[model samples]
Target: MTDEKNMNHNNEEIIEKAKKFFREIIAENHVKNTEKLENIKEFKVNPFTHKYLANFLTGNDDPKSLAKALIYPRVLGTSITTSFGQNLQTFVNTTLEGYGSTTTGMDIEFIDKLDGRKKYCQIKAGPQTINKDDVTTIRNHFRDVINLGRTNGIPIANMDCVVGVFYGTYNDLSAFYKNLAEDYTVLAGKDFWYHLTGDEDFYNKLTDAIGEIANEFDGTELLEKTINQLAMQLQQVDGIDE
Candidate 1:
C-alpha cells in the first residue's frame, strides 16, 4: 500500500511538471501571435487539455465572453479544426487513441473528397439527426472524455484531441445548418421581390430622383411621386399584403 501511494504521488508530480511545460509552450505561442499574456490561462495537460485549449482559443472559456465572441467568426472560422472534415477517420483514430478511450459509438461516413485532396470521413454520433441541444451535449461529452483520458496518463497530444472536438462540433451543428437553410427559404419566399427588384427602369428613376433632390428644392413634388411609385412597385412585386 505504501509503495502504491508513493507511485501515485510520483505520477502526480510528473503530471504537474507536464502541465507546467505545456503552459509555457502555449504562452510562447500566444505571445508570438501578439496575444496578451493575461488573456491566456495556465495550461492543464490532462485528457481534456485540448478541449480547454480550444475553448480558450475560441473565446468560450466564459459564457458571457463566448456569447460576445460568437457574434463574429473567430475561432470557428479560423481554426485548423474547421477544415477537419477533410480527414475525419484519421483524426478520430488519433484523438481516441490519444485519450485512450474504448472507441464508443465510432462510425465513419464518407464525404466527397475536396479539391481532389483528402477523402473526408464524418464521425457519426448516432442513427438520428443532430440538433442544437445535441451540439451542447456532445461538446460537453467530448470535454469529459478527453479529461478522463488525460487523468489516466494516456500520452495523448492536444492536436489529436482538438481534431476530434472539431469534428464532433461540426456534426452536432449539422442540424442547425439545415434549420438555417429552411428559415432562409421561408424568409425569401415571403420577400421574393426584395432580391429581384434591380431593374434598369428602377435604377434610372432612382438616379433621376437623387439628382433632382440634390439639384433643386422645387423637385420635392417629383421626388415624393417617384418615392411613392417605387414603394408601390416594390410592394406589388414582393406580394406584400396592402
Candidate 2:
C-alpha cells in the first residue's frame, strides 16, 4: 500500500513538472511574439498598447488583459499564429502515429506507400461552422493534384480528401460533405476521433483523460499565476524603458 501511494505521488509530480515546462515555453513564446508585434508599423502605433500597458501597471490580471498582452498579438495575422498552427499540426501528427506523414498543400497529410494512396486532411477546432472559402480552396487543391497526376501519366485514383473537426453536439455533417465529391469525407467530434484512432470510444477516453488532468491540478490557478508573471515582466520592461 505504501509503495502504491509513493508511485502515485511520483506520477503526480511528473505531471505537474510537465505542465510547468509547457507553461514556461508558452510564456517565452509570448514574450518573443510581443517583440515581433512591436516591429509591425500598425501594431507599433496601435492604441491598444496604451490600454494594455496601463492594465499591466495597475497589476490587473484580468483575462482580457492577459489575452491582450499574450494571445492577441501572437494571433494578429503574424507568423506566430502560423507557427502555433504548425505546432498543433505536430500534436495531431504525434497522436496519430503509424498513420502517415504530414504533407504540404494541406493542414495534415497522410501517405500510404503500401497502397500507393494518400489522404489530404484539413482540421478545424469546432464543428458546424465549415468555411465556404476553405472548402473551395481544398477542392481546388485536390483538383490540381489529380490533374498533375494525369499529366504525368500516373493516375492517382486512390487519393482522398478529408476534414476533421474537434467538437460538436451534432454528429451529422453529410450536408457539408455533399458539397465535395464522392472521394471526400467530413468527420465531426467522436466520428473524427474514431476515424483517426480506429477506436470507437477513443473520444470518451480523450475526454476522461482531460478530466483526469484537471483533477490532478488546478488549471485556473496556474493560468492566474502565469498572468501575474507576465504582468510583472511587462512592468519591469516599462520601468527600464522610461
Candidate 3:
C-alpha cells in the first residue's frame, strides 16, 4: 500500500511540474496577447472590416497567421520579393479588406522576354497623400499575409518575380531594384498570376495547408484542458502529504 501511494505521489509531482512549465512558456511567449482588446473599439466600428481584423489579430483562429508564420521569415531576410510574395499579398488584400495601404508607391512590372518589351501591372497602394504610418501598416499587413501564405504551403523561395516600386529619383529606384533583383528572379509578365489562378494543384495544396493550420488552432482548447487536469492531479498529491 505504501509503495502504491508513493508512486501516485511521484506522478502527481510530475504533473505539477508540467503545468508550471507550460504556464511559464505561455507567459513568456505572450500567447494571450495575440489580440489587442483596446484596438477592438476601432475595429468594431466596421463589422465587415472587424471580421478580417480578428483573423489578423487573433493567431488562434486566424488561418492567415499560420501562412504568414511559415513564409515571412524566409523572404524578409532577402532583399528581393518572390512570385509567392506577390500572390500571397493579393490573396490577403482581397480576403481582408482595409488590410493593405492606399499608397501608390509601388508598381508591378511585367517584362516579355521574347519581345524584349515590358508591360506594367501597376497597383497603387492608394494615393500620394498616404501617410508613413499607413504605409508601415500596409507593409506589415502584407508581411502577415505572407506568413499566412507560408502556413498554406506556399514556399518563400518562390517569391522571386515580384518587384517593389518607390517614388524617387532614378538612382534611388534603380539602386533599390538592382539590389532586390540580385536576390530574386523578376516575373517577366502578369502571366504568373494567371497561371496561379488556373493551377488547381496549387489551390489544393493551399487548401490542405490551411486545413492543417486550423486543426492545430482547434487543438489548443484540448491542450488547455489537459493542463488543468494535470494541475488538479498535482494538487491532490500535495494534499495527501499533509
lDDT (CA) for every model shown?
Answer: 0.32, 0.52, 0.34
Best by lDDT: 2
Candidate 1: TM-score? 0.20
Over 55-134, each residue of candidate 3 has an lDDT whose tens digit, in order, gives 56554423333223322332233211233233434433443222233424323333323343332222322113234464
**What is the total number of backbone clashes in candidate 2?**
0
Candidate 1 per-residue lDDT, tens place, 38-123, comes to 12221122333433543765655443332223222322243222233333444334422222334333232121111221111123
TM-score of each: 0.20, 0.47, 0.21
Candidate number of the best TM-score: 2
lDDT of candidate 3 at residue 124, scale 0 to 100: 25
Error of 3 at 55 (Å): 24
Model 2 Cα lDDT, one tens digit per residue, 40-141: 222332354656664775566453364345534344445444444445545454444344433445566554223335666677655544567766876777
Models ranked on lDDT: 2, 3, 1
- On a 0 to 100 scale, what is the lDDT of residue 122 in model 1? 22
Instruction: Order the candidates by TM-score, highest first.
Output: 2, 3, 1
Name the regions of candidate 1 deviating beyond 4 angstroms.
1-101, 104-122, 125-128, 155-242
